[model samples]
Target: MKAQGVVLATRYVLVTLIALLVILPFALMFMATFREHTDIIRRGPLALPQHFSVDNFRKVLFQHHFDRYYLNSILITVPVVGGSLVFALMSAFALSVMDFPLKRFFLLGVVSFGVMIPEVFIMIPLFQLMHGLGLVNNLLSVILPSLAMSACFSTLVIRSFFMGLPRELLDSAMVDGATFWEILWKIYTPLAIPAIVTSGALTAVWTWNTYITPLVLIHDPLKMPLPLGLALFQGQYVANVPLIMTGATLTALPPIVVYLLLQPRVVLGITQGALK
Candidate 1:
């Protein structure tokens, strides 16, 4: 009994230590946002500031045009997350529940081809396609391609969720003379919200932080999203550390806010679908 208690206590201590290590840097950054730049530099990131200043956030929001980038981020992330979720759910539903030839082949294709293909390898082709459409500096360039591209992991996850639904529920819907579209709308979609939220949360973060695609396709400074905007906070000799930290903190809020709102669904989805 004593031996088991010691082992459990040791495990708890290890987990706590690991969690603190993971959380400390973000905590330091959050604190630094309210501190003066000189204090941050003098203290070497570990010490507290002499006084709290909202000046960093104020300057970034007002003087540096961070608000526009924040808005741009929202415009890009919202559509991308919504479109990706819709596309993945619809495709996964058909792939998971329907009877068709090349069904296995298609699933294999999603798993194999989608995951293995590196974005770098296709960047040149993607840029050319964007240029041809005259979408180089447009938000549509980000939104449209995001909609069309398949996320294998999301498809796999939603497929698992769809597979877990009782076979009879779908059959009963069909027996009632419901069409596929009707059944999908009235039944499947409502039931799939939890899983969809999980997928949305994932897509939201990725689309928000997208740097390379925007860098290659976006030429206008005013149109750049938050990650690209961070570049402006850096200078040759003296980096704007406080302002950069402030930008990062502000940029991080939206996704975290979205996640908090949908956290229940995420938890429920994972718990319910864990076996799959």
Candidate 2:
């Protein structure tokens, strides 16, 4: 009993220390946002703030044009998350429940292929395609490709969950005259909530934080998303550390909020999926 107690205590202590190490930098950054830039420079970021204010946040949101960039992110992420969820669910449903030929080919050739290919490797072709379509500086250029990319991965996730569901349950539903769409939306979808949220949350964060794709395809300031817009915080020679940190904090907030809102199901979905 004593040996087991010692081991458990050591585990808790180690976990606490690791947690602090991970959290302290972000904590300092959040606190520094309330302090003046000059104060952070003079006292160091580790020093406690002399006063608390939201001036840096205001400056970042209004003076720095982060608001426009934020709006751009919203416009892009919303469609990617919502649209890709629908596509992934539909494709996953067909793959999981229905019998069809060429199914394995579709899974391996297209879905797995999308997952394995590096996003950076396709930038040139993607850029040329967007340019040819006159979507070079349009949000659609980012939205369309991101939607497709997310759908492929999400399909795999939801498909695993669907496949794990009991065969008898689905067969009984069909005997009761449930149509394909009816089984998917009314039956599997409700049961697959956790998997759906997991995929949606993951896609939302990826789309929101994407820098490379937008940089390659978009040049107009108006079309740039939040991650790309972070470049505006630096100059030829100087960078405002606090201002940049504040923007970084704000940029990271939405995904964090979304995940927390759906955290319980996300955890449940991941756990169940792993067990399967």
Candidate 3:
């Protein structure tokens, strides 16, 4: 009993420390948003401002056009998350239950391998491809590649859930004169909600924070998403520490809200998978 209590206490202490480690940077950013720019620059990031104000956030959001950046982020993130999940679900269904020649090759050689390769290696080729398509400076330049990448991971995760489903369900559905298409949508999909939600939430978060793809492809200030926009905003306001942190905080806000709201579904998906 004493050993168990000791282990539990130590485990909680470790988790609390890790939680603080993850949260401290955002905490600092939020704190800095209300602090003086000069206060942060002179006294470092940790210093308390002599007076707190909302002028920095107001300037970043309204005067400097962070709202435009926010809209650009929405334009890019929405299509990527929606399209990626659709592709992922269809592909995952085929991979999980359907049979076809070269199926293993496509899964192992293409999809799995694509995930292993770093995005940096393909940036040049991706940019060239986008340029060839006349998509440079267009939001589609970011959306297409992000959708494809997000779909790959979503497919892998959704497939596992589909594969775990009982074969009897499919056999029974078929006996009732249901087609494969119906089986996929009418039967399989309902059971895979947790998995789909999990995939979607993760995809949404990644698409929301996409920096590299936009950086490599998007050049127009109007088309740039939040991450790139924030970087440029920081550069333009080089001396204004508080304004930079305000942009960072707002840019990071959406994903944090998304992950929190969808957290229960994520946990449910993992729990269901584990039980299976």
Candidate 4:
């Protein structure tokens, strides 16, 4: 009993230490956002601020037009997440439930291999394609590619979840005159909410933080998303640490909120998928 108690104590201490390591950066950043630039320079990043103020946040949101950039982020993130999940769900359903010639080949050879290819390698070709399609410097350039790339892993995750589901349910539904679409929507979808939410949240976070794609494809200042916009905001406020940190904090909020809200579902979906 004493030995077991010591082991449990050690585990708790280790987990607490790791949790602090993960949280310290964000805690410091949040504190820094409230400090003035002069105070930050004088006191150092780790030092407590002499005074806290909301002026930095105001400057970032109003003076820098971070709100517009935020709107742009919503526009890009929403469509990419929705479109990718829709494509992924349908593709995963087909792969999980249906039998067709070359299905295994497509799943392994194409989808699996596609995930291994880095997005950086395809940027140039993608740029040319976007230009050819007259989508260069447009939001579609960013949104379309994000949707396509995100679908690769999203499909795999959802497919794993679908495969874990009882085959008898689908087979029984079909015998009762249910079409593929009806079975997918009426039966599979209702039960797969956790997996869908998990996939959507992950894709939303990725799309929200996407920087390079938008930086390369979009030129209009008004249309840049939060990630790219924050970079520009940082450049313009290089000496102003508080303002820069404020922008950083704001940029980090959406994904943090998303994960916090759906953390349970994400954990459940991943564990269930992995077990199957």
> What tens digits encode model 2's per-residue C-alpha lDDT throughout 4-91?
9999999999999999999898888788778877887798878987788899999988988889999999999999999999999999
- How do the residues 1-276 of candidate 1 rate in per-residue lDDT, one tens digit apiece? 999999999999999999999988778778888887787677788887677779889998888888888888889888887777777877788887788888888888665466456556677888999999899989888776554553554676778788889999999999999988887768888998767768767667767877777777777878888887776555421476777788888877777777678888766545654444
| For model 4, the run of ten residues with the poorest summed lDDT | 267-276
After superposing candidate 4 on the true structure, give the runs of residues whose Cα lies further than 4 Å from its correct spot: 1-9, 49-52, 267-276
Clashes of each: 0, 0, 0, 0
lDDT of 3 by residue, 79-111 (tens): 888898888888988998999999999888877
Model 1 misplaced stretches (Cα beyond 4 Å) = 1-5, 42-44, 110-112, 150-153, 235-238, 260-276
Residues 16-117 of candidate 4 have per-residue lDDT tens digits of 999999999999889998888777778788997667778888888988989889999999988998888888888999999999999989899988776567
RMSD of each: 3.0, 2.4, 3.1, 2.4
Let me know the TM-score candidate 3 reaches against the reference structure. 0.88
lDDT accuracy of residue 179 in candidate 1: 88
Model 3 ranges off by over 4 Å: 1-14, 39-53, 264-276
- By the lDDT metric, which is better: model 3 or model 4? 4
C-alpha local distance difference test of each model: 0.76, 0.86, 0.85, 0.86
lDDT of 1: 0.76
| Window of ten residues with lowest summed lDDT in model 3 | 267-276
Cα-based RMSD of candidate 2 = 2.4
